[model samples]
Target: MRDDAPHTSNVPYLPRRSVHLDFHTSPLITPIAQQFDPQEFADRFARLGVDSVTLFAKCHHGQLYYDTDRAERHPGLGGVDLLRSQIDALRPLGIRTPIYISVLFDEHAATTHPEWVCVDEEGGPVRVDSHGVPGWHVLDMTSGYRSYLAEQVTDVLGHFPDADGFFYDICFDQLSSSATARAAAIEAGFDPDSPAGRLDAAAAVSHDYMGRLRDMVAGDGHDGVPRSVFFNSRPRLRLADELGFSTHDEIEALPTGGWGYAYAPSVARSVIPIQPRAIGMTGRFFGSWGDSASIHPAAALQYESLQMVSLGLGICIGDSLPPAGRSHEAVTARLADTFARVQAVQECATGAQRVAEVAVMRAPITGGEGVIHADAPGAGELAALRLLTSRGIDFDFIGPGDDLAGYRAVIVLSGVGIDDGVVRSLTLHVESGGALVLSGLPDDVASLQPLTGLSSADVDGFAREFVRPNAAATGLPDFDFVLPGAVRRVRAEGDVHTLATVTEPYFDRTPDRFSGHEYTPAGAATAYPAIVARERVATAAFGLFEAYGATGVPEIGDLAAATLEAVFPRPALRIDGAAHLEGTLGRRSGSSIVHLLSYLPSRRSSADIETVVDPVPALDVAVRVRLDDRSPRAVRTLEGVELPFSVEDGYVHFTVSFDDGHCLVVVEEE
Candidate 1:
């Protein structure tokens, strides 16, 4: 498939503005949904511009919200049938209602049937945390819980035939040493006794059940339309392998909930190339789920929502419905305002594809664990997100499965393992005149020596070093710049140009030999090259990406950007603006949209929470878009205000400004 082509599937239409309502009611709570007024509830969502709502069918508490004879309903619900009522209320108002089901963490099941609990290799039951604390227990899917889950799902399907889709939560593999798991592993041709074998077997079992559940959902449709199926909590790194079990991708990244703000954009960029129709899920609370009364700032919501839509992704704001089923007034108000802003730019963002000329290989996960969180933003990935986006360089996070032919440049950050397939693809890319940039050497550096033109690449025995750009290097100071990270020593063979040299520190910081408070200062310049280039391939001795992520160093970004520009001079998009501004270019058949967002988040309190409190000031931004031979018929904002532009050397140049933290400009073809 072409990189820009839409990922067409039989899934239901994805709503731009949606809500994931959590209703994990405890059995002790009485009179659930007692205050729920169907018309009022549906009206509020419609007024907020919400087109879809995911209501809970079964929650982690193992309480069914709908009327079912095969399972236990929340004791507080009485005869309310919360899920049915929610669907009936919203469906008539032209709102899509998707059902949510908890797959692994079921409190009631774990407490009632001890045999159904998942067991670790150490013979300990798997759970969220200590048993003394209040947390959900994981149930073994290979055990009897599988039948119970399937029966409950079938019941939901039969009852809510009009539902638009299904969202399965906690759909990750678990390492288990149970009898059923061992037997299933053996049947699947895997040895259960080996740790690697057990991990593989667990993933196989999870994938099998997910596929079966997806088929079941697909088989039962609403009229002639197919229902969307998404297995939440699956790792983004393995999306290529698990895409078969999902109809649409929904990234559940609550920034305040342990996932930093960079996680969503990194994951979204990676996902949209594979599945254009995807949702970026964030939460309305200040922290994570279960924070009922707490509300995030309106500015924060606007920043997140605008950024998501700018990337051509649907927006889903996560929320927890209180026991009385009343909406949080303050939170809903902020959401209503944010949704209005999103609706305003829907015209420019609706069908446009992300225009990227650079592909950065995402860093591999630590430990190579089978059951990993969906959003694993490594230091390199986070730096890539910061550097690329801030520089207004449109790019995408790629994996081994992605085709490198579509991009003009491919960047392999440090810490990303290079497998045979990746090596082959990158070699082909470089041979075809595409730019190839690499950071510090990975474990498989020997395999790429010929391509990199490096006679030797080894780690220098220095904890910290400095980079000194040569006189020929542009946009870099002549003085040495501190690189507070591990440095690698490299020697280029024949026909290679040295961009920068290494400046070694006096000594490694020891308890007794430390020079300063932190580490030693730079001592002397070494002949070993810090940055080198052969043809279109550029190599860095240290991980500029990693250093930038670990420490907010402006010099690192500048050097990285300069190196990239040296090799990949003509990018798809470039914006000259403040570092606070992030830009993305989106293109359709005849027009292109340029999205500009500016927001600075800071630590608000003593806690680690970061929030945006001030509005962005107005500033003009100069932009250059590579349109090749095409001429612009019109250049205007989404509001139709025309702007003057000129095309020079294959780039269409224009300037735009905004004061409300987000701006979108449209360029039409003649």
Candidate 2:
């Protein structure tokens, strides 16, 4: 294990409110810096409560915004140093301005030196089209473009000596199918076309480039003034050890933009622990980044900002500067409204450590393939997160190799196959009195049988089945028929108790045996166990979470919650609120903060966009926090309103009227 100490930044400050300004300009949009008034821009940012902003030093078109001696300035902007002017204006206002430099897609560099462009196996330049715009050719870092990029970065640093950090964009893996890349791979003893080989080669090249960049930036810092470095992609992977913060441009254009509302939260939750400082970048475009005139609703921005803070992540709202260089007042006002709310909650959330009782373990794929089992872990994990957060379960999304000792329970999502090391760790955790919940058919079930007390013979069927609770299943009703997606039959033995049994349908819905629309009618329950439970471990054969995530089935979540309650027995915090209300718990300096966020979107049915409406009044919501030996001294909202509460059964209970889209409850302990 390598020490991660050097990767941590010594920078003393982190801004909760920040903006990522996009300035990817084209020749058609000339006079790039004409409308950009430094004072007006600084004033707008100050009014919006922005403490940090990333100004573009070089755009994807490979045009320099500043008066760079090494690189050509944009032909549209002859002599205006837009980057220098913005930094000069904002720095005096106590704002940290980072320089944004496009690393991969540099059109000017690719055009000027065609040999430096990334080429495919056919010896042709690789180009990518984005958002109906003709894609620019990406530069190959292994070529002389690497030296040019370094010189450009060094020039920017020299010009802006007081700059805050560097934001490297489009620095992910660029798979080269080019003959040159193939020859290089062959020299390095790897197949150019193999997925693993290509991935490894790309990783090596990226590592070298990022390492050189970090060294150059670090070497430039003097007198305890550290310059932060962050890459756009792979924030949690290869470059995490070298970067200052983990960042993902989660431009979640909900309802339409391909990314549903659940994607950003899942990514935020998973990446927060990987880096000491994690920031989520979301754009304000109505559709996405390129929509210049489109403005995201204020309410939606508010919800997104609050969600990021609650997940222990800094929020960076994305906005593209208009070609005229003038900041949009309407967008600034909308962002101001959201930033004010973010500023209020961040006072308590800042420096707070997340308190999670459950850690969801993401398993590796089977067959030694270094790939995720599904596309983005699928909806099963997302639905599980939705259900758990709605129920006020304090949980964290953890990946492989993350420490599991801190959590009281662990959930292995459906379809994830565990390796031997993970199996051993999980078995040890179970033996040490930790709760374990296994969903779906894990590939390494044979190794987990001792902990689960159930051995799988084979998958019996793949039809629609219902799960009816047995008479012995306490806290769960027998009438609940959960439609678990794919049924896997397991043989219960050695103190393993069957909590529920699978009720098979009349017949499989074949071409000839079809009943009505979807599947055949349900029949009586069978002897096979749908859910099996032991002392510290509970295993389910059905892909219940997958079904629930795909269909939003309440029965599946209900069964899962009940089973978890039975197994874990006591969770850290419990909240009685609407399903749309989500809660996150954290502690800082002897006090606990509970962040309650509302998910009531305005346009729920619109597939084009999601907008947040007025906040729903959640009255008389009871929140119970289990305090082992500490006594509650005071309970109040973030706005300092005292809330009435009581203590019983070693837990503090409080009822709050959450009227806003976000509410924070601070519990002072004695």
Best by TM-score: 1
**Candidate 2 overall Cα lDDT vs. reference?**
0.74
**What digit string (tens of lDDT, one per residue) describes model 2 on residues 57-165?**
9989898888776646787786778888888888777677878889898998988999988887677888876766768797888788898999898888788776677
Segments in model 2 whose C-alpha atoms lie over 4 Å from true places: 1-9, 121-124, 220-223, 235-257, 365-377, 441-446, 457-459, 470-485, 494-497, 602-608
Index of the highest-lDDT prediction: 1
Query: What TM-score does candidate 1 reach?
Result: 0.92
Candidate 1: Cα lDDT at 61? 88
All-Cα superposition RMSD per candidate: 3.5, 4.3
After superposition, candidate 1 runs with Cα above 4 Å error = 1-11, 120-124, 129-133, 186-194, 366-374, 417-423, 442-451, 457-463, 484-486, 493-495, 508-514
The 10-residue segment with the lowest total lDDT in model 1? 1-10
Q: What tens digits encode model 1's per-residue C-alpha lDDT throughout 339-363? A: 8888888755667887787899866
